[model samples]
Target: MPLAALIVITILAHSAFNGSRVTISLYALSLGASPLTVGFFISLYSALPMFLGVAAGRMIDRVGMRRPLLVSTTVLVCAVALPGLVPTLYPLYVAAACIGTSFMVFHIAVQHMVGETSTDENRRNNFGWLALGFATSNFIGPVLSGFSIDLLGHRETFLILASLAATSLFLVYRWRNQLRHTVHDKPPAAHGGAIELLRIAELRRVFICTGLLASAWDLFVFAMPIYGTSIGLSASTIGLILGSFAVATFIVRLALPWLTRHIREWTMITLTFGVALLAYTIFPFVSSVMLLAAIAFLLGLGLGATQPSVMSLMYTTAPEGRAGEAMGVRSTVLNVSHTFLPLLFGGAGSALGMGPVFWTMAGLLAVGGKIADRRRREVSAQGSG
Candidate 1:
């Protein structure tokens, strides 16, 4: 049931995310909005998710996953469907916000579910599989959406996404009874307030590390395509580069179970961050499309490795029976980074050009790695005691 839910959700969510920029940006362009307005609309999508993520997490704990999942998926289907009907910038922005809200709800609920279902013995593997599922969707969604849009146009593409989301909703409904049973059968444990959750030392370190790394991840992913275009890459070439990145990410995640057994979680986290830093530093220097694709592949491997490891660590460190809240906090911090980092990088890129922005991203990764190293040492020391 978990695997089924993960598969459907990944497909629908990725389709929405990958198709949204194309649909919304084109919609805004058609409405006579400037480049700046398009940027604002994109920023709003990320910002809305960050703003609602923690609240969504709390709501998931307060209620159960089924109600929120159903409601959020329903609203998202409507949001996707509405844009095709109205075709205006205001309505498009509203739809984007709704999509963001739905994503936040779905994200929190799913992570909580994954964390709750797996034992410590298999937690990392479970997360690795989840990451692989998401990466696969990320790989497939944009390419499919682009092709569909070319054949059917943007409005039609959105309607297709709406249909996919509805299919996901139906899957969730099928598993509804099982989901409630899982939630009810779990032993009672502390349901900490947000502050109390934050007070767990290991969990706090995980949050900080996850947030900082995610900020760098978002900055690179958001900025890279625009940067590539500025250097004369075709739209299709840019898509291929990003798509290759996703492919590499999926590949690395498939190997994570093996990798995690051989390397300490902290060591893997540090190594992935270092690789990411190197990729960002070298990103602006590459001009050839082939070379850029190579760098993107390396970047994807690093970025992909970091997330599941962090999630696994957080799940293990979380107080017993509070995995839901811990996973919720992890998702919240990640969503927060997703919200702001792009806007920050976009502004920086606008002011100083792509080269400088890439350099800035490298610096951020370096800083994040240093912090993670310190936190890992602290965790190790605490465990030893």
Candidate 2:
């Protein structure tokens, strides 16, 4: 299938998954779950994905995307629907874990498919298009989730998301013949494993920077609703704040073609850290919904711009036939952020307040930017030499 088809599929699956994050968080809160418990809930989304990410990538490398894509999408449909049918906080925990793991597999497979399908000349733009699809879904997911919850209640909203996922499952099933298995046919070298992939210094830095930006991204997704609630914002308003962030992602991605021409990849990433760090630094001080959305928009621009650049860099940097595995390693790194930050920052936010959580994240961003800058200097020096 073409990249456009993959993007369409991605937008559907991702929208469902993204919407579920807000729905689950708010639903748990409605049921009297505390910030710590909410954090645990959000953390569960990353738990299985964290451990399984690398292996799933390697598996996709061997099996191709057709079966895995259908299977994962089906799993997504079931997971999203479970909460709607059960309508309980405990069932949500099960749904969260499955969504993360199954999507992790689907995500890696889709990315590999895109890279293999594209050439050097158009790779960034193709990925840019993919990111645009994600940005679109980000908007659709949360805005729809928030409104759906307010209009129909959380359970029905989940059922609505499940319907969106089911549509994705149907499309993949229909298009099974069109999907290519993979590009890299040679077996991954025996010496090559996750650890070996990480040992490459430049690719390793890409993983590090990607992880930090991902943490910032996931942090907002995980925390925005909780913070909005603490300060008396309605669910719809909280969703709007998150929605504004998605809008920013869409805008930056729209400009990616022009940006890539003038800005180098590492430069874009390091600058993103600075941008995101600023957003987080200001988040705790602001209480207005508009202001929160503006900050969210700003953070979105920063972190949003990073995904295409990071994916482009990873694909270009990987040793042949190993791009899927490389992506898997990157996924592992990202899931670590997904899994650890919620629990860590969730506990921190619960005990010390959201201000500490925001500021602490700012500290991590500062470190991430410093590392990226150092790596950029190394790359520049190598080019000159």
| Top-lDDT candidate index | 2
Per-residue lDDT tens digits for candidate 2, residues 1-385, read: 8787889999999999999998999999999999788878788888788888888887777778788899999999999999999977789889999988888888998998888888887887788889889889978898899899999999899999999999998888888988987644577557558889889987888998888888889899889998999999999899789878878889999998788777878889889999998999999889988789889989988888988779999999988777888899888888898778777888888999888898988999999999988877887898899
Residue 84 in model 2: shift from native, Å?
A: 3.8
**Against the correct fold, how does model 2 do in TM-score?**
0.87
Candidate 1, poorest ten consecutive residues by summed lDDT:
180-189
Most accurate candidate by TM-score: 1
- lDDT (10s digit) by residue, model 1, range 6-29: 666766765676576677777678
Clashing residue pairs in candidate 1 are: none
Whole-model Cα lDDT of every candidate shown, in order = 0.76, 0.87
